[model samples]
Target chain A: MIRWLLLLMLAAGPALAVGDPADQLPNPAQEERARVIGRELRCMVCQNQSIEDSDADLARDLRRIVREQVAQGKPDEAVLTFVHERYGDFVLLKPPFKMATALLWGMPAIALLGGALLIRGMRRRQRVAPGPQELTQAERDRLAQLSGRPRE
Target chain B: MSEAAPNPEAAAWRRRALLLAPLAAAGLGGAGFYAMLRGLGTGDYDPRGVPSALIGKAPPDFSLPPLEGTGLPGLSAADLRTGKPMLVNFFASWCVPCVIEHPQLMRLAREGVAIMGIAYKDKPVDSLGFLKQRGTPYARLGVDQPGRVAIDWGLYGVPETYLLDKGGIIRWRMAGPVTEEILAQQVTPLLRRYA
Candidate 1:
């Protein structure tokens, strides 16, 4: 049981150390706010990862900035706007809906609608397709003659 | 009784029309793929080329102390409004690209361009040593020990250089090392234009 407990603790080790950087503010509430904000801000160094999730030096700097802003009593929107103004729209993990990002945000839905239309068109075509017609006596006779066989 | 079958040509046309569904889908898919590739090629997909929001805006004011005992003057935002365009270079002793660009900075300094340096997130002693070894190319050198001033400048990383006009508005920013080709083609033209 002790060995199993030790293994569990070891498994949780990295998770505990993940976002607990030395730069975290001493105020727990402020730190929490910073974390919330940081989670929404992309790490400029690691584009796909949020600053809260990235361990890159740049990310740490960003996190510190966020914490400092929060500690200074800045509102969340103001803090976000500050970084956005400096880094452009790329620093936000969730890009705002705008003219430039319309295609990025709408492409999946557009593709889905296109796919649905295609499938519906295919199904409708299949439904409207004419069934195989029974061979007429004359066509049967012609086939028999061509094949050199006796007609039924 | 004789019966006629459907017209062969009309049926062929209908079949061809039915093929349009998949063809349109294939076209849409191809377009999406092409867009994704283009986005990856030129858009914010590459963060290095991400545009600085400070391009047209005046830089925030800052006053940083010179590196301890270097005898260099400290840099301030007010110094940039000297009625002549200048360059502000952010570098660190540890950054390899900064070493690569040091000689170019020296050449620019030699050409009478007033350049200010920020030793970003570096120790004062290391910065002093670096300037001593590589030769000083800056009119003023400031040490950003905790990097608060750097964050205020929205610096992405070390080895970033910004060209400010006489009014202290940032005109152009280069993110990485200053190669000779870049200096000639990009920097020199801008300097001449601003001059």
Candidate 2:
């Protein structure tokens, strides 16, 4: 019975270990920062690949730098700024609010405003247009009588 | 003598239609957003699952400058057919995955696997600097700076390795990091079989 239990436990050990690789890593705080930084930074070697997805040598190096900076207690903005200094703005998908990135930053607001204006315009037209309800009581009664209802 | 009231159901329906216009717009907008995500190639895909054109076909034929520029000779697909199987790795100095896989690559080189390296989309100077620091495991090295050669081989990203047979046809291709287990199970058997 003990032998069977040992075998079962041994088999289950590796299965448990495979669950989440991140859990085995040393620091969760640093790892989380690294992950956040990685998603922001574009992989220089692969076109369209973020650091998180890239397996390139440079991606690994950048990931190491992120972890190191985080472990050293660097602020998120500071770490990002440091990397940006070396890599430039192209490295970030969500570019900073700046002259060159004005379009990207302002797009959502512009869309919202435009939509609001369009809906407002539609509502105004609907309000102004006379419908069947706009008719006077006498007109409604006349129409109803014409349509064979009891005349008032 | 009583006034005729409006058709209550019809009036309610008109109100409901007004309410539903925005809902319909929202549904259409949502579908459009979903299509944009997929159509723009931004959707998620496992890099490892991406198929390589060179997997079953003959690798591209080309020559490159040696590490030392020793002028010994350049490597080509023909070099793969020398009675022993070979491994060709496409890497760049700038790729992080390539760095992670470097130790494994170095071990493979030490094991007399007869590896060929391709420098993809990198400057010659950078490539040389990388090999210098990393220690060259590549029996032969090729430079593909224009990236035309890599595209021809259907390479999506860096750190892709191919195992070619004695006939220069690719037997297997690995798109991501090659672990020790992959080398032991998949690569070793092929190498031994070809040998």
Candidate 3:
């Protein structure tokens, strides 16, 4: 039981370290909002991590910026636009649907439709396929003769 | 009895189409891979390269103080719009890549290219020492001790260089150290085109 408790604490450790206590907003609601926005914003320095989750200096700076904006009562979209203006679409984890990203956003749907069509086509082919036919009387008699048995 | 067959003409066309589908996909993938390899060789399509949003826009407003103990003037946003193409290099004293990139900057300076330097996240004393050792290639040097200006410029890391057109619009940004090959291949062509 002690070992399991130790393992659980180890797993919980990283989650506890996410946002620095000093970086949090005074109001819990505002802090929560800041975290929501931070999670959506990519840490440009870390490439694969959200600013809220990364320990990089730039990420920490971005987190502070987000909390500051939130504390200032700026709307979520306004705060996002502030960052988006500087970092471009790459900083948005969810790339906004645009002409440049149309193919990227459309690929999954296209693949799904293509796959459905392929399965449908295969099913249709299986249904139309020829089945075995019964042997004629003449063929049956020939088979019996070939086997060296008296014709029945 | 066998189920009715699909329309003969349609079936034949569909069969051939199905047969060609994998080949077509393979051909497209091969072409993409070939382009990617070629891009890799030319340093053109780095998966890590983040295209700057600052391109075609003015640099963010900033007025950084000159590095202490250095006699160079401080850099400001207004200074960049002096009706000539210039380079804005963000480097740090501790960044090894900056040392590698220094010779290229020196050569450009010798050829009369206007280059501005921002000492990002480094002590002014260290920056002064680094420049003194490197033979100072910048026309103006600024110290961004807290790196606030760097964040505004969307700097990813140290040793990033931005090429500004004559209008002060940023045309290109490189996130790594400049090399002789990069100078001859990318920088020279862009300088001529923008000039």
Candidate 4:
């Protein structure tokens, strides 16, 4: 009986999370598309979570807007642009490549190139003087002379 | 790719530079952080401030019904483009920040500034009671019961204020309570610049 109760709870849990069934599109394909778009939108309230993942009221409203746009047969870009026009680039989880975002987009490539150069420099450094060379016989004799110790 | 052995002086210089790199970086970062903290203390920096996209653009189309029992006229987007700059404020009965901002709004209205109010996501009865208690400063009022109109305006939080130019373009926006200092420093300057 307890197992049955637990199973019942597990089934009901996701239904509650799906939230306000009226917001979902009737077409399954459209619903999936709406969800994909939702994942790209930032929740303005939470500042971190995507509208798809956040339970904030603003997130819900954005999700509903995405679904409505999808149901209207709007392309993904058009729907995204509709939101972008209203909320600006901050709403996009992946910021668009523009003069304003050039630095943000270029940083990973810059870091990668820096890392490659660093590794090559280290490799060249390692190869040039393959670690500390064994002291020459003259150097060893000189070291012994300086320290006043007999060479073994 | 020099075949000769590395110069000892050059290698030593590189080693010294590598050692000092982190210290220099830390010093620069610490100075920047200290400046940011000082700005925060002086109310010059707002870490959570999000620049509003609606600035320099007209507001989204909306026409909200007035709250019942208020006897105030409803507000709409058409009412905004009347060749007069005005303030649009979204507040709620339950928002404590709205209460704090109310006095400034009242002061502005006393000086004959056209102020429009939207009761955001609050019940009509609660809004009416709130207005009754505080005395409405609004020249025109609307109730956004379902908050759809708020979403159209890209409103994420309540107690937000917008200043519109004579052309009905949004000139400035303040997201939190409009305290006395903010009224004197920022909003007053923005109003003149747009005017």
Candidate 5:
């Protein structure tokens, strides 16, 4: 019975530790908005983690700022722009399409098209008749000389 | 010869194109790979520095209390527009780099540069104690407890210094500890330019 109780407690432990207590807001609606925004903002310090997932001090501060802005009735884009203006494009998990990032976004499609064209060309080349196994002028001349015939 | 002999010039051109096409693609691919490697190697190039969006913009207003027992007046954004260039430094007792940067601040203070210090995220008592031992270089010191002021200033971390022109527009920002070299080379020249 004690072993079963211990197993049950272990199973429940993960559920208790799932959500971050620091991210809670006074209003549930505002908290949900903050959560959505936080997921979109990258933690500048941690680089790899979103502000929602990072436990870095700067991330916590940013989360508070987001919650405060949301509580103040700022829209989602306004809140994102606030952080974006300060940190540049790097703070956004999804970088906006702009002149600077045009090449970055276009490279994959260009590579794909280029690959397709290359494959098509290769297939076309294979379908072409292995054009006349004709001898070169030197080879013909040598052949004629070796066969004891007059040069043509 | 076969039923139809291929045009020799055209065949030669086709052969050259076939040979050059993959070579050109490989060259491009290699260049792209090299660029990617260089980008990755220089990732987090300015890890300590985040360029402030507030540059050329007026600083946000604030009325922070002074650090206790420092005998220095509290600072406001309006005070920065004194018709002369000034430096605003964000620091804290808890920050190790702030301690390292203290001497450079002292030298600037001694040279008659007007510097305003914001004690970020530190207790008044601790900040006062730290200044007392290390010597306060600020003409005016403000205590930013919750760091709302620092946030408005677009601060990423402690030990960031901003050079503001006479009109209170931020001209330049230096993140991380101010070494003697940076103080001499970048800071002094900009200060003179604005002056």
Candidate 6:
């Protein structure tokens, strides 16, 4: 009798184990946390969108990989590191500041400084009185015509 | 008539403002260009660093339609809790990478690795046509029109494959075309471990 019961339990094990979508879902808290993390990651396949936004197969695979890693008790940083190792910096929306990627980080500041200097230089140039040589005879004539005065 | 040239102070202020105008314009122009460069994704384009929400969590539950005449519906991560492990591949008819990885998928399928394909964000007819032309190695295929299903899976693009163990836990995943080296080194070993 016990053996028959054990056999019955074994037969029911898989049926019990098979879960519907609601049953198999991760905890809500965990899902929210994962969603936050996913939002920061770039989708390797889709150029502009975050992984959270993309529906590309590559994106889905990436999400599954992230979920598995998290479930395995890997830290968020470690999970990112694993992906980065495989896909290179291009897979990241935010590239770290490294020798290979330093330009990306530096460009904005460089541009701002350059812009300020150009503005300052233009201001200085604008302040400089028109050089005596600025007006050619043709310009003088045009000015005179416009002013209704004789050309000098 | 106005006395000589303007007062020295007025002339200096006028000169300063005039000089500053172009300089300010240049500065604005530079800033605009900088923004443009950043937005363009430039050579710095990288996606790996993008954080993932699914990381460190269980895969979402989802299903796909079966390939033609397989009778079985598409396999899901939930279904993977069965006896053997499985692989899920996201592909599209228009994707070059899908073509590149087609043979790899076929080999896995032939080895009884339980590989399934999701026809991601593609037209059904085109996906079917692609399978006809390239030979379907997928045990089944699910259509993901408009890519919402892929989004639910957190997909970035097509040609991504996920490995699930007998317990329905994801074991491995690949982002791009699965090179032979990758298959030999990473996927095959994982399968053996799970097997």
Candidate closest to the true structure, highest DockQ: 3
Candidate 2 lDDT by residue in tens digits, B74-138: 56656767777888899988988888878888998898888888888787778778877987878
Q: Which pairs in model 3 have colliding backbones?
A: none
- Highest TM-score, which number? 3
**Better-scoring candidate (TM-score), 3 or 4:** 3
| Candidate 1 CAPRI assessment class | acceptable
Which runs in model 2 stand beyond 4 Å of their true positions? Answer: A1-152, B1-48, B68-72
Fnat of each candidate? 0.57, 0.00, 0.70, 0.52, 0.30, 0.17
Lowest lDDT 10-residue stretch of candidate 4 chain A: A13-22
lDDT of 5 by residue, B6-48 (tens): 6888877887999999999999999988887764454323434
TM-score of 6: 0.45
CAPRI category for model 6 = incorrect
TM-score of each: 0.76, 0.42, 0.83, 0.80, 0.74, 0.45
lDDT of 2 by residue, A14-84 (tens): 56422134422378767877788778987766748776666665566566667777888889898888666
Error of 1 at B189 (Å): 2.3
Return whichever of 2 and 5 wins on TM-score.
Answer: 5
Interface RMSD of 3: 3.0
Candidate 4: tens digits of C-alpha lDDT, residues B1-195: 333445878877888999999999999999999999987765567787777889889999989998779789999999998787889999999999999989998998887778999999898999889889988899889999888888777788889999999899998888888888888888777777766
RMSDs, each prediction? 6.7, 15.3, 5.3, 5.4, 7.3, 18.0
Point out the worst 10-residue segment of candidate 2 chain B by lDDT: B39-48
In the range A1-152, model 6's lDDT, one tens digit per residue, is 99999999999865653223342227666555555666667766557776656665556556666666777777878877766655556667787889978888999999999999999997986676454447788888999999999767
lDDT of 3 by residue, B36-138 (tens): 9998777777878899989989999999998867789999999998888889999999999999999999999999999999999998888988998988899
Off by over 4 Å in 4: A1-18, A123-152, B1-23, B41-43
Better of 2 and 4 by DockQ: 4
The sequence of per-residue lDDT tens digits that candidate 5 reaches over residues A1-152 is 99999999999865653346866897898998999999999886667888888776778888899998999899999999988877677788998899988988899999999999999997886678576569999999999999999999
Worst 10 residues of 2 chain A by lDDT: A16-25
Point out where model 6 deviates above 4 Å.
A1-152, B1-56, B66-72
Name model 5 segments beyond 4 Å from true. A1-22, A26-29, A107-132, A136-141, A147-152, B1-48
Error of 2 at A17 (Å): 41
